[model samples]
Target: MVYLDNNATTRLDDAVLQAMLPFLKDEYGNASSTQHRMGRKANEAIQKARIQIAQSLSASDPSEIFFTSGATEAINWALKGVAERYTSLGNHIITSQTEHPAVLQTCAQLQKRGFEITYLPVGRDGLINLEDLKSSIAEKTILVCLMAANNETGVINPIADVANICQERNVLFLCDATQYIGKTDTVNLQNIPIDLLCVSAHKFHGPKGIGALYIRRKRQPIQLETMIAGGQQEKGFRGGTYSVHNIVGMGEAIAHSAETDWRSIANKRDYLEQELAEKLKHVAINGEQHDRLCNTSSITIKHVLSSELMSQIPDIAISSGSACATGTRDPSHVLLAMGLSPDDAKCTIRISLSKYTTDGEIEQTIEAIVAAVHKIRSNSPTWMLFEKGLLD
Candidate 1:
């Protein structure tokens, strides 16, 4: 299958697999157990992986990084950690309507338990208004959780500006950077006054179930209450035996992404869009093209139902929106919040490329999409009426 669903998850790198084989087979020791040579090796590997992840994010120290099951867990840790630790300061949190379900659902759960959450709306271009953010911050607001890049639309948020506002207000800033890393180099971490940042390794070609959270050393580290209580696994904040193989794989993936040249990937993504746009009409790009990730495109066809057409092109793997909502058939909340109608929302599909994607594969996917859109539009009664000028 032609895998254009890099946002959903990535195929594991062969190098990552090779790096992890020893841990899965012979070096199977719990990281917490430091008595034996095997245990020491496992513990050392975990520490090394932590440093690799830390370096990738330009983090000051490895101790400031917390490993988790994935970005979802990291997000939960950040939100609940700050809320519980600083409960006396305030109980209100702010985030955007375009965040992943991981961030949105966690905030929703917090609301059920008496916490106040303000969901900031995005513009038609999928950008959160900075002025709206300033107005939304109340004296009671304790934290703001905004994603660095949108998972569905691939739009990059103005995180540095948001961080500046948060800094001046003395409110904590948390950025979910899962979709941004690997696709683009992050803004200097030292310059941004964010308190916490989260990333998933699998999104960048690592094994599933491994991710990291970066806590700024300059800020009063969020004193989040632990979601899991056990032995002091992650410095008493999170408790569980670390996965040796997964952690190593995550480190390998981060190292690979950081070292590779990204300009080529950006060029390929541009080529895919130019070729597809040339071959098809009545298609709209979903987000601001200039501000989006070089490896992702969210496209909407005037009359195409996303799943129906996507099903016809079995070789090209893509999505209707976020990977978490791919099979739901629900209209994208991200698009709806951006003012797209339910019909337009259903017509949207996302194509996420990676460094591994090939030019030939992009051409094939474009050919298939061109044909599928034509097929769907030809059968659509709405298109018939609109073409005949019977309906505006």
Candidate 2:
């Protein structure tokens, strides 16, 4: 099968698997244990992984990085922990409508606790207006949550600008960089005024069920109320036994990403887009005018249902929307937020490539998409009307 859904999750790199295998077998020990050699070894390995992740992000210190189950858990902890800790300072938060459900749902939970959330709207290109964000920041606003790159559309947000705005307002900035971390250079984040950042291992070819949150340890030290209380793992912020294998895998995967030729991946993505445009008519590339990720292409076929098209091309692994929302039949909230009608949103599919994706795979995917879309559009009543010049 031609796998074109790297945005959802990437295959584990061989090096990463090799690094993790030892910890999963003979070297297994609790990171919290420090009395014995085995426990000390595990603890040292966890610290090394933390340092590796910190170095990858160019963070100031390894102490600032905390491991979590994944991006979802990190996001929830960041949002809820900050909300509870800073309630006396402010009860209002700002975010965009195109955020992952982790952020949106956490904001919803905060709303129940009487914290007001202002969800800024996005344009047709899936980018937030800085002016709208600036205007929304009231005296009660304590935090601004935004993503570095959109998962579905892959549209890169103006995070530096947002960070500057937050810094000017003296509010905390939280960036969900799950989609941006390995694909881009975020190592020099010290220059940006972001306080909190989230990244997932699986999104960057690491094992699943492990991620990290970067908490900037400057100025006031970005205080947070503990979410899980038990052990002193992750500086007492998160309480749980460390998943040593996953952590090792995450570090190895990130290290491997540094050697990837991203330009080649971008070339493949561009070639795929060019092929799609050549083969299909009235095909809309969502967020085409914006600065998007090099590996993602969100396309909408004018008269075809995305589900039907995907069904026709079963050999090509693609997604109609996010993997997190797989069972839901609703249209993409990200597309709808970008002014796409429900029908247009339903007709959209997200195709994301990886560094391992080959030219041959891209060619096969394009052929499959073209054939599938043509078959679906031929049976579509809307296409028939448009062909007869009876539909606008």
Candidate 3:
């Protein structure tokens, strides 16, 4: 199948799998144990992986990286941990309405407990207004959580600007950078001034269930109260034995992506969009066209159900939104936040690519999409209106 769902997750790279094999077999030992050679080896491997991940993000200190199950868990730790640690400072937090469910759901839970949350709305192009953010900030605002790139539309937010504003105001900035990392070259943490950042390995050709959160270190040393308290693991911030194999695979994946040129991948993706869009008259590009990940394109076809049409292309795999919620009827909250009507949101399809995708695959995908669209529209009365010249 021609997989176009890189935004959801990726097939783990061969190198990543190779790196993980030793850890899963003979190197299997609890990194927490230091009494034996086997344990020491595991400990060293984990530390090496940590440094690799930190270096990939341009983090100065490896200790600032905290491994977690994935971006969702990291986001949870950032929001809840900071909120609890800085409760004496304030009870208000700021975020965008288009944030992932992990951030929004956590914010909802906090709101239930009386912590005020200000959800800033975005424009029709999926951009949060900086002026709106300035207006939302108050003395009680202690934290601001925003995503670097949206999962569904792949629109990259102005995170550096947001981070700078939050830094000037002394409000902690938490960014979900999961969808942006390996797909682009914007991982420089220095430019962003982010206090906390989240990234998932699976989104970038690494194994699932492995990710990291970068916590900035300063004189104040951003202290977060432990949520998963137990065995004093992960500097006592997170408690549990580390998944050595998954971490090794993640490190290998990031290392490879860092060395590879992403512009080529971007060109291939753009070619696919250009080729298909030239033939599809009812097509509309969703989100901000320029301020997006190079490997992603979210498009809307008028009067078409994206999921239903995509299923007709048996050789192609695509999506309507986040794979987590693909089977649901509820419209994408991300698209809705960008002022899209429910119908518009439901008719949208997300095509994501990776460096491994080939030119031939892209061409095949375009043909598949064209066929699918034709089949679906032929039976659609809404499509008939346009053909009958009744819809201008």
Candidate 4:
């Protein structure tokens, strides 16, 4: 099957699997134990993986990185941990309407606890207005939570600008970098003044159920209330036994991503979009005018349902929206936030690529999409009327 849903999860790299094997087979020991050689070896491996992750993100201190099950858990830890800790300073949080449900739902939970949440709106291009963000920061605002890149549209937000604004305001900046980490140059994070960042390994050719959160230690370290309380793992911030094999896989995957040729991947993504546009009329490229991720293309075919189109091309693995929101029947909240009508949102499909994606796969995906869209639209009376200039 031609897989074009890398944003949801990528295929694990061979190197990553290779790195994980030794840990899974022989080096199985609790990283929390330090009395025995086996436990010491596991602990040493975890520390090495932590350093690899820290260096990949240009973090000066390895201790600042905290491992979690995935971006969702990291996001929860970042948002809830800050809100609980800083309640004496402020009770207000700022975020965008197009954030992943991880952020949005956490904000909702905060609102239940009487913490005010300001959800800034996004434009048609799925980018939030920095001005709106600046004006929303009141004296009670303690955190500004924003995503670095959108999962569905792949639109990169002006995170550096948002970080600057938050820094100037003295409010903590939390960036959900799950979609941005391996796809782009996140190494410049050292200079960005962001306080907290979240990333998932599965988004970058690593194993699922493993991710990291970067907490800037040099910047007047903001203390977070511990979410899980038991062991001293992750500097007592998170409490759990480390998944040694998964951590090793994450480290190897990120190391491999650093050497990948992203420009070629971008070119393949562009070619697929170009082919789709040339072959299909009434095709709208979502967030086309904005700076987006190199590997994603969110397309909307007029009068065609994305589910129906995907059903027609069953061999091509794609997503109508985010994998997290797959079972929900509602239109994509990200598209809805970007001013797309429910019908337009329902008709949208997100095609994301990875380094493993090939030119042959892109060509096959384009042909399948064009054929599927044509077949679906041909049966639509709305498409017929629009084609004949009788409907707008």
Q: Backbone clashes in each candidate structure, one number apiece? A: 1, 1, 0, 0
Give the Å shift of residue 208 in candidate 1. Answer: 0.2
What would the per-residue lDDT of candidate 3 be over residues 116-148, giving only the tens digit for each residue?
Answer: 999999898888999999889999899999999
Selected candidate, larger lDDT, 3 vs 4: 4
Where does the lowest 10-residue lDDT sum fall in candidate 1? Answer: 218-227
The lDDT per prediction is 0.88, 0.90, 0.88, 0.90
lDDT of 2 by residue, 147-257 (tens): 999999989998999999999989999999999988866546777878999999999999999999899988667888897898888878788888999999998888778
TM-score of 1: 0.97
RMSD of each: 1.4, 1.0, 1.4, 1.1
CA shift at 318, candidate 2, in angstroms?
A: 0.4
What ranges in model 1 sit over 4 Å off?
Answer: none
What lDDT is reached at residue 19 by model 4?
90
User: TM-scores for all candidates?
Assistant: 0.97, 0.98, 0.97, 0.98
What is the lDDT for 335 in model 4?
Answer: 95
**Which is the better candidate, 2 or 3, if ranked by TM-score?**
2
Ten-residue stretch with the least lDDT total in model 3: 281-290
Query: What is candidate 1's lDDT per residue for 1-392, written digit by digit as tens?
Result: 89999899988988999999999999999888999889999999999999988787777788888899999999998998888888898999999999999999999999998999999998888998999999999999999999999988889999999999999998999999999987888546877777899989999889999998888877445677886898899888788888999999999899888765578777877787777778877678888544888788888887678888888898889999997875686799999999998998898889898888988888889889888878877888988987888864
